[model samples]
Every structure is written in structure tokens, then in C-alpha cells.
Target: MAKGLCALLWLQKLMTELSHSHDHIKHIEVDCHFIKQNLDSRVIQFPFMKSEDQLVDILIKAYSTLDKLSMQDIYAPLKGMDGLKDEDHRNLIGGVVGEVQQHFPDASFMVFNFGDQESQSQIPELLSDMPVMNYPIHHGDCPILAMEIIHHFLRAADGWLSLDEHKNMLLVHCERGGWPVLAFMLAALLLYRKESNGEEETLHLIYNKAPSDLLRLISPLNPLPSQLRYLHYIATSNVHSEGCLRYKSLTLDSVILRFIPCLDAEVGCHLMFNISGRDPHNLTDKTPTVLFSAPERGKDIKQYKQADHKLVKVDIHCPVQGDVVLECMRVRAGLEHGETLFRVMFNTAYLLENNLMLGLDQMDVTWDRQNQYSRAFSAEITFLEMNPAAS
Candidate 1:
């Protein structure tokens, strides 16, 4: 009887161990099901690792050891500390500029925004060390000036920076306001480096070149007018200046025009004028009217297209110098009498600033219909040589 009783006690102990093992196995199965569901739903994507191809050397290989140690240090009193919790790297919530600086501490930053006081003020707050450049409120004004600023920075001082440039020009912006600017800026960069053919051509490359999912991430910011001019300028002069003023400009207006490859190689500019119409105000009967010599065609008398539309083609050739003193005979005739029309101040100065000295083909004056010059005055110009010719 005593032997039989001892045998029954051992059997009972074995049954209890089996029961505990069954419960532990069920718990593991439940955990595995959760993981499998997440995988099916794509909530969890396992990163592929080809390094060494060792199971023991996997990313989570150290997890088992370090995790246990880490768990031991976890405070039991903390809320929800009883179960295993999945973690990911997506928890990082930092500013873009800040994150970039974390990786490349010495990287230079230039923020392009709407230039409103509110938006610009945030830049210094985010990056205290970096400087700021405003795109200016150019409603109908030429945006080439703005585009030039961007093209200069991306290409560096010598205009040679590319995808593999010495210092990477990591483009970043906060929110979505600067999407249009970014689109133009990036397109210009790609064109400058010759990584792509033309603006629209390169823009397509930007769209198709990206990964499918990430490609959809871009905002369809329409190309700006200034950006279009950049394309034209690039296509025309291919002004790839490998000049010495390689360092970034200090201000938006501080473009190193001397760095244009063609201009940089020359002493200055050579100028030859082709004025189509005599400025109406200049009525000096005795004054010698100048004649414009067309390179392809012979000289023609400067006059209105049909004596109705007040349009004039000012085809200037820089055979010697980029600077040309434009004397609108019509305007001069207006000035000598009373010095009244401030048209010269507005029209002449702006025309020079926006479309002069960079080897432009011509400045076509769309004279003001109102006869005030300021009301309807506009100039359309082209580059001296397209990018192919310049190259």
C-alpha cells in the first residue's frame, strides 16, 4: 500500500508539469498570431539583411540579451509595463533641418520661403546659425533673378556641383508652402549639372526617376515664370561659370554675374545696338539718328511695325561690352522740354537690372500704349548663346 501511494504522488506531479507546459504553449501561440496578423496587414515590414547572412548576427540578435537586461531595469510601477510592446524608428519627431544637421553637422542651410515676416522669422528660430533669402513679392516681375539665386547655390562657386558634389546640397523645407520653389530649384540643379537635358525634359526625369511610392509624395507645384527663364537661359548661354566667387552669396541681390563661364572668360562685353523705332519724344531734327546693324541681315530704318502699334525691337549685340547706353529718342524728346516723365527711371533701370549684361540676344520693348512708358512698358530678351553653343 505505501509503494502504491508513493507512485500515485509522482504521477500527480508529472500531470501538473504537463498542464503548465500546455498553458505556456497556448500563450506563445497567441503572441505568434498577433505578429502574423501584423505581417499580413503590412503593419510590420521586415527589413532585408544580406550582411554576413547569419541568423545569430541579425539586428534582433542582440535584442534578446539587451532586451532582457533593459526589461529588468524597467519600473514595475510604470503604467502598462506588464506586456511586450512593439517599437519602431518612426517615433522621432524632429525638424528636417535639425535632423540633417544631426548627420552632417557642417552642412550649409539656406531657407527659401514666401519672405513674410512670420514665415522668415521661424527660420532663424529653427536654425539660429544659418542665413535667410526671400524670393521677393514678384507678382508680374521677371522671376529670373530669383531662379539665378537658386542656380548659383546648387552649382557652387565654380558651377560644377552635381549629384556627387563635394558637399551634398540636401534640399529640405518645412510644411508645403515652398513646394513650387523646391520644384524649380531642383529642376535647375539637375539641368545645371547636365544630369538631364532641358527644364521640362528634366522635370519629367524628376517625376519618373523617383521610386513609385516616393514619386507620388511630391506636390505638383507648377513651374514658376522665373524658373522658365532659368530654363531658357540654361538652354541658351549654358552659362556654366567656373568662376572664383564660389562661396555662397551673402544676400539675394548679391549674384556673382562675373562667374558666368562665358563672361568670366571675356574681358567684359562688346555691344552693338539694333533699335527698331525712334523714341517718339526725341524730335531733335538735327540729331543724327543711329542705325542698328543686324548680323544676319543688313541695316533697316528704325520705325514702328505699322506706324500703329508702339512696339520696338532693341536687338543689342555685345560684340565688346555687356553695358549698353540705351537712348530712346522718343523719350529723350519728352525729357528735354520739361524733364517730366519719370519713365526712364522706372523702365530703363528695371530693364537693365533684369535682362542685361548676361549675354542676352535682344531686349524687345513693348512700349506703353498709354504713351506713359510705365503703363505698358515691358521687355522680352533672349540669351546670346544657348547652352549647347555656350558649352
Candidate 2:
């Protein structure tokens, strides 16, 4: 009984921490949410920065000094920090949060010295009188997006992007979705500033997506549907080919939430029209739309409930269970037109019945030796067009 009570108590605490309103936490406040570093210095000024504004100095200066900064500079202040300095840039961003493993690590508030060249390790004889400032990044926030924004600023041609002019760019939008939108604006600038890629690649990146899906989700530039589909919240809609699979459309869980039950302002449209200097004919509408079939058109549409049942191929081996069996299934809903829509979902109740992890997040077959998902698994429902009827 005591052990059970302890377990219950632990669960409650975890729930509280997970659901805590970020607004209540000042760190998660719009201005500080993006930077994960915790700073608590008492009026101790570096040679190049104001006492209280050391972080701003570090951030703005970092842009100009990125090419000059060595691995030693990034970690000089984080002395006691574990982990190798050579982690990938993605991990490097997470390192700011201190917990590198979590997709969204907990926010951190820390302070380390800047420009302590004498104390700096890993730098043999690199010379620098470069200005250094304390910078902050939130581990709990999206670091990859943050990195992209930083690079965008560095690579941008506009004088304003240099922070030398737009000194307060970081504080532009300090609201829930606003800060992220600022990042998207930077990222979008990076994409179109080149004015490169073909239309298909552009749409694919927008709808199908990239590692920086967070930027894509809240942004209002999806030109594919022109309107968000309201009824069915989402579909994988992946087209498979060539010994490997990739999403043809930039679609993901983050993308699904772009439009749904509710949508906020047209921040994306604003960026598209104003910053990019592009006409906003298609990306401006801010609401998800609905389509209803008219009775007149319904008579011409033939629906096939059952087209065929194709087993979902796992493309993996599973340890066979004596009495328990699992099967992959597929169902097709053929519309009156040429397009055939397929709905696919897990067929077994075994997962829920046994309290196993649903494994919904992993898009491809996963194999693990530990935890509930030790067995490899992945399944999908695909839709394709058959034959076109003359209009």
C-alpha cells in the first residue's frame, strides 16, 4: 500500500510540472523563453558590456563573432558542463538547456563568465580582442529553430538583420506564438532571400516539412490547399518510392495543428506580404475552411466502401507470440472521382489492453531492445488516384 501511494504521488507531481502554465513562469515569458541560460549576476560588467545587459551583448555580438568563435568560446563559461564539445549543432543547441536528450528539454537559468580567455580551455593560441557578451537560449523551447534564425541573420544581406541596426530584434514578439513567428520570419527570409527552388520543392518543404517543422506549422504560408481542411484534422498522405520513403508534402503533427479547431492572427500572411515584399493573394486567409457536397453533385459521385484489403507491411521481424497474433490491415474509400482515399489504423487491441506505449510518434518501423516498444513497428494508410473520369 505504501509503495502504491508513493507511485501515485510521483505521478501527480510529474503531471503538475508538465502542465504548468508557462505564462506563470517569467522565464517562459516571451522575451526570455527562447534563451535557456539562467543569469544572476550583480552589476559585474565585462569590459565590452553593461552589467545587466551582458546577455544582449553576447547575443548581438555572437552574430558578428560567430566565424571567430571557437569551441572554446562556447564552453568557456560552461566549465562544469558534461558532454563532449563536438556534439552536432542540434545537440549544441540543446546543450544550452542542459538536458540534451529530451525533444523539449526543461528550461534552464544559468550564468557563466564571458571573455575569460585566461580561464578558457580548448583554445591553444587563438588571438581575440573580440567583444563577448553573455547569451541565453531556452532548452524547453525549439533550439533547432533558434539556430536556423541565428544562421539566417548571419547570412542575410539586409543591414537591419545584422543586429547592428535591428538591435532589439529578439524582443520583437514576446507572446506565446509570437516569438516563434519571429524565428519563422528569419527562416522564411533565408528560404526566399535566395529566390531559388522550383515550385514543387517549395511546396514540398512547406507541406511535407523539414526538421524545423515548428517554423512551418505556425507560419501562414502553406499554398498547397489554400484552405485548411476542417473535418479530418490530418492524414499522412505519404507517397512511397525508391527503396526509401519521404513525405511529398510538408505534413507532420505540428503541421496538423496549423489549422484546426481554432487559429490565431495571420502573422504568417503579414510576414509574407510585408517582409518578403511578396503579394499575399493566397496565404492571407486565416480560417480553416469546410467543403460540403451538394445534393445535385452527390448523384454523380459513386462511393466504394470496400476496394481491397492490403496488409500493412511492417518490413521488420517480430518475436512470435504463442496465442497472441497481430495483423496489419488497410481499407479504401474510393470517391466518385479518380482519387482513392485510404484509412489506416492499428488493428490490435493488445497495446491498450496490455498498457503498452502506442508508438504513434515513430513514423517508420522501430526496433528496440528495451522498454515497451522493444519490438519494431510502423504502419500507414496510403491514398492514390486510379483512373480519371473526363470532366
Candidate 3:
């Protein structure tokens, strides 16, 4: 009777051990399913390795008793596998500039501004030795100056930074680092990644790498632009003559002119111009008084075609030394001088060409139209040159 009782007790203990083993197996399956779901969604990947080979390697591979136990303790926490989180690098939150500088000491920064003259004037002093490029509100009249600033930065500065031997160079803006800055950053990263890694990869990243929520950090007074228009031009425009700035439907009479001096390199800025006319269907090369030049066909006064409704182009070449002047000769149908505003549009492509110098803004005068040179009015204004600290 005693012998039979002892045998029954041993069988019961074996059964309990098997039940625990089955529960452990079920838990592992649940963890793996979660990981697979994340991976399929392009969220993350798992680096595979046996737990024993990982933190527990001390036990199996080590000859020393202390090393074996140490490895086991380290690996103990990692026994339950888990998924990794995604990285959002572009969010501006919590003094990220300071944190980035700590990792990349030699990182450089550039600040571009047109509307913020006072703040812009002070940037060079604040970020000494770093570059600050400014675009003046030119012609006091045109709307397309924004596009000119975009092209210059991308073609000249964007390409050269990677080769500058600086590890952590950065470009920072105030509340609204949208439009111009975003386009450049995206293009720069895309170009960098393409050169660093061949096109083929297991995954496509960067679509959501920028942190959206952190934009709340910018003060309400400042807001990023809604769309990145300059990059849109780079991705779309036709190649025009060396010094020719071309765009579709250029309402030459209503363009704005901005004078930007000392834009960094040959293409130190980006420019955009758009024109429109009545007879909506006849908006082509023959639209009259509109200028279009192409390198292949040489110079020709062309008419706008029905197809050329919205023309766009960019010039990377920036004239380093000279004055950019703009003048308008004509005003729309019926409006007083002060009542109607005329925007003078100039070709930035022409401005950035090598060896070209612009002395002043010009407007072709007509008896019925007013020209800039003919004006008798005069006013004194203080002009600030390059950023003081940059000097």
C-alpha cells in the first residue's frame, strides 16, 4: 500500500509541470502576434536573438562563475519580448536645438527671413559666425519674391553642406518653419539619403518622421505656411535661359519686386512668379509684351498658349554683388496712383547668371503708363547690409 501511494504522488507532480509549460507557450504566441501586426503596418522591426545568447550569455559561454550568473541576471528582464517604438526626429520640442548641439558640436545653422527685419537684423548677433540670409521686401509691391528665396537655398547651400565635414549642422526658424524651410529640409534629406543609400530598400520612411504635435510649440502669432510652393516649382518648371526668369501668365503689370543682396552661393535663393490675363483662352506666348527665353531656341518674344496657363521655373544662380531694382510702367484699366498697386516682376534666373550685374530696377515707359525712373518723389531710408555678426 505505501509503495502504490508514493507512485501516485510522483505522477501528479509531473502533470502539474506539464500544465505550467503549456501556459508559458500560449503567452509567447500572444507576444509574437502583436509584433507581427506592428511590422505589417510599417511601424517597426524586431532584432532576433535567443535570450540565452543575449543577456544570459554569461552563463553558457563564460568559464568564470561570476560571469555566468551576471549574464543570467541581465537577460532575466528581457525574457518577455516586446516591440520597439518609432522615432520622430523633426519635432521641435523641449529645447531640441540644445540637445542636438550636444551630439553634434560642429553643426551650423542658417536663418532666412523677409518680413521680420528687426528680428532678422539681430540674428547674426545671436548666432555668431553662422550665416543669416535675408530677402528684403522689394519693390514694396510684388508677391513672387517668396519663390526666389526658395530656389537659391536649395541649389547652392543645400548641396554643399554634406561635404562641409560638419556632423550636426542645422537650420532653425521661429514659430513658422514651414514652406521655404520645410521644402529645403525635405529635399536635403531626400538627396542625402539617395546618395548614402541606393534607392532599393526594404522599407520607405520619412513620410511621418516629422512630429506633428510639436508644432504647437510655435507661438500663436507665428504660423507655418500652408503649402510648400517653391519645391513644387523645382519638381515642375521648364529649364529656361541662363538669366531668364520665366513663368506662365505673368501679369507683368501686377508683380512685386524684392531686392536681396549677398544671398549665400550662386543659387542662394528661390523665386516664383505667376501671371494671368483676360481672354482666358488666349493666355499663351502670343499674349503680347510677355518675355520668354529658352536656352535651346535662343531668345524669342513668344505668346502664351492655352496649355501654358501656369508656368513655373527656378534659378539657383544668385548674383552675389549688384543691385536688384524693379519698376512698373503700367497700371490696370481705371484706378488712381495710390488706389491701384502695380507689382514689377523681374527674372531671377537672369539675376543669378554668372558675370551678370544689375544696376537698378527698370520699367519700360509708355505715354499712358508711369515708369519708376520718371518719379520725382524722394525719401531717405536706412538700409542694413549683411548680418552684422556674419561679418
Candidate 4:
């Protein structure tokens, strides 16, 4: 995978040079340089693989003939069917199910629909004989909440997939604009089954299965940071455990923003923070609470000048537990609305250090121009204390 990624980076670099557009390469420039340095120093090398033998083809290219043939046969009945109409959609689904039954007579099928109630109801009545589970998820949903929901999903999905004695088939369906949640679920399943290891890589691989612009079109704000955070949780924690996962209590002392980005206003920028997480005091409440919000009502919003200093500090001291999401936004002078500068999400149960530091590339930024912020743009979150608890 490392070699494949290196090859991809090299290709991206070449494309950027040919197109003379640096926009697409900014995010990966550091990585490309690192890979180049390693190669120059003979520390690492990418061995060439024949096109026919390249396993990465499964991820980047179309499926093999056998796999495509199987899929076509199962979904042959739905050929040329219009997907926009409700009647057509229902018939298409039913026809596909009928085709599946014809192809695999003894196979048991399960449908997991990641869509809203309205979309779930659109499932054909013909599938009444098969098990259909509905798990509705909205766009830009809270990562912590998504984590809990994914836990339940993994339990049920894994149970069906593990039944080796019977030929079981799992069909995952999602409504329009449900790709984010669907991608996250697929990545989690890969990690749970030990088929993939790295959280970022697995998540990116799944998302790359679709068009590059699909995610941006579906979601305005970048969801990868929060998604990656949850992916890290899935990779590190034991989701198969019987009870709720234990989380340690921690206090966020302060946030230090270094090499702050230059804003359009001359008066600098007003920084507002919103920290949310599972209720530390109420274990039964599954909903996340706003642990802290800066610039309280009637209180003055502090403005920090980027040219004055290299570091900006915001004291939070908010108590948080379980999964935590910290978001920072920069408001221009005289403007009520603010753009999110970056977001960080993590679970207290997996905190092995007193502080969490993230570089520019590691965070989710709303801006497109990376040159506006210094390469040193980063955030450091200090933890005052952590109460160690059993896993």
C-alpha cells in the first residue's frame, strides 16, 4: 500500500506540473517531498508491478470480468429502469431481489438501508420476506453519535457475515447524498474484519471508489477530519465488547493556535469555539452536549491579530468525556457569520498523551487556498488532567 501510495503521489506531482495548477497538490506536497527524500536516501523504494498483476487495480479500476458478470446477473432485471421515479425505484429493487433469488436460490439476503424514514419506506414490498434493517443518518452528523450507531451496525452485520455454514449475502443500500455515512460504515467493516489496518487509508480508499467531486458536492464542510477521528477510534478500540466503551474524564485547559491564517479584515479575527461530547455527568444520555462555547452572551468576543504574534491562546478549561469534538471558527470583523478554521475530534478513552497536536495537513479546513496560512499553521490542545479508568 505504501508503494502504491508513493506511485500515486508521484503521478499527482507530474500532473500538477503538466497542468501548472498547484491547487490540487498543496495538500500532498509535504508527503511527496517526504517520499522523495526517502527515495533519494535509499531508505525506501517502489518496485514496479505489471498492470495485469497489480492488486491496486481492484481499488482504482473497474472490477474483474467475473465480479462484473456476477453483479450484472444479479441486477440484470433492473436494466434501463429509471431511478428517479418512486414506482420505478421500487420495481427496480424488487426485480433485483428476484434476480438474486433466481441466481442464488439457497442464499439468505439482508438489506441494510442507510437512509431517512422516507427513503427506507421506498423499499419494495417484495423484500418483505427478507430481513431489512433501517438506519437513518443525516449529512454532517456528529461523529460521536455516528460512532455509537456504527457500533450497533457492526454487531448485526458481523453476525450475519460470520455465518459461514449458510450462504449469506449482505446488500448495503443508501439514498442520495448518503455516501459519507456509507463510506464510513464500509471502512469500519473493513477494520473490524481485519481486512484493512490504517483508518485514514481505509476511509480514503472507500471514498475514492466514487468520483473525486462527489464528497464536496454532497457536503459543504469537509467531513474527513471528524470521520478520520472516528475511524481511529474504530481501529484502536474493541467494538465487539458487550457493554458501552469506557471513557476517561479530561479537562481541556487551553488551545494554542500557531501561525494563524491571515484574514481579510485588518482588525484581525474573532475566534469562537464550540466543544461537544457525550455528557460526562449523565451516562444514560446518549446525545452530545455543548461542553463549552466561547464569546458567551453579552461577553466581548476577543480579537487576535495575526501580525502581532505567532501564537494565539484561548482558554477553555471545559470538562469532557467519551467522544469529543472541538471546532474553531474565525469571524471577520463586522460579520456575524464565521467560517470554520479547523476541527478536531477524539475519544477520551484513547488519549495516551497530555496534549494533542495537529498540523495543517492533519486538520479539516474550510478554505481552499493553503498559501493563506503559513505552513506552520497548527493547533495544540492541552489536557489539564485525565482520570484513568478501566478499558
In candidate 4, position 43 carries an lDDT of: 88
Q: Highest TM-score among the candidates is held by which one?
A: 4
Cα lDDT tens digits, model 4, 45-139, are 55665433444322232122223323221222234433256676677677766755664576677788776545436653547777988776542
TM-score of 3: 0.31
lDDT of 1 by residue, 190-279 (tens): 565555576666655443433333312222212232355455555544355544222110111111112111111222222223332222
Which window of 10 residues has the lowest lDDT sum in candidate 3? 57-66
Q: Tens-digit lDDT track for model 2 on 1-391?
A: 2243356556445435535655567544443332222212323221333322333332233232222222122222234453244444235543432321131122112212112222332212111221222222211121112222223332432334344432322211112222233333333333433342343343343332223343343332221221111001111211111222211211011001111111113211100000011111222431212111112133343222211111221122121111111212111232222211111112111122321222323211112211332223323322222122310
Error of 3 at 241 (Å): 10
lDDT of 3 by residue, 112-220 (tens): 4333433434435544666666543322222223343445544444444445533323343332223223323344334333332321120112212233333232212
Model 2, runs deviating above 4 Å? 1-48, 51-158, 163-170, 174-183, 186-297, 306-391
| lDDT winner, 1 or 2 | 1
Per-residue lDDT value at 191 in model 4 = 83
lDDT per model vs. reference: 0.34, 0.24, 0.31, 0.67
